[model samples]
Target: MLLIAVAMTAILLLAAGVVAYVAFPHRGQRMPVVPWLGHAMGKAVNAMPTGTAPQDFYEPQETSAR
Candidate 1:
């Protein structure tokens, strides 16, 4: 049935993604097993805004000199 075929395809794609995640080097390090996917992921990350640092939430304390 068409539903079975779709399920099988989904399973195969999921397996491929898992294998690529494990086998490939992280993005911006070395070449990945799947270049296009790595490039897409890198672009997506770069497009996002930078995260706030922990220091941003607190004021700096002044030290008293002896």
Candidate 2:
């Protein structure tokens, strides 16, 4: 019984993570559902930095070449 309960809890947490990812696809490097999880994690989370490029990357930039 204890094993089954633990398995269920793990599955539930995974499901919640999946759902949160789908719901906030553009949130950019956030903990699945618990926002504070990142803050609480502190140095651990920042240890390995990851990010997406800015949305304007493809846009033309003004230049003084001319």
Candidate 3:
């Protein structure tokens, strides 16, 4: 029972780490704790498809009212 608990905890921690890596934006630089893993994570995030391109409908006009 104890061994199973330990294994479960380890797995949970790993899953959390992976989620954190993917969710946060770490452009260009690697994670301080794990450089190689950070690099891999960055690549994985880039590989995923971004469904739509952003559109800018109109340019802002200068107004006297602040």
**What are the C-alpha RMSDs, in order, of all predicted structures?**
6.7, 8.7, 6.7
* Candidate 2 per-residue C-alpha lDDT over 1-66 given as tens digits, one digit per residue, 9 for 90 to 100: 999999999999989756665555335566656767544444454576799899999999999986
The models' CA-based lDDT, in order, is: 0.68, 0.68, 0.74
Best candidate, TM-score: 3
**Most lDDT-accurate candidate:** 3
Which stretches of model 2 miss by more than 4 angstroms?
26-66
Q: Residues 1-66, candidate 1, lDDT per residue (tens digit)?
A: 999999999999999866664455343453445577766656666787997788746887789999
Per-residue C-alpha lDDT of model 3 across residues 16-64, encoded as one tens digit per residue: 8766675553545556677787777777878989777546537676799
Report the poorest 10 consecutive residues by lDDT, candidate 1: 23-32
Worst 10 residues of 3 by lDDT: 22-31
TM-scores of all candidate predictions against the true structure: 0.46, 0.41, 0.46
Residue 46 of candidate 1: its Cα lDDT? 74
- Cα displacement (angstroms), candidate 1, residue 48, comes to 13
Candidate 3 CA-lDDT value: 0.74
In candidate 1, the residue pairs with backbone N, CA or C atoms under 3 Å apart (3 or more residues apart, or in different chains) clash, namely none
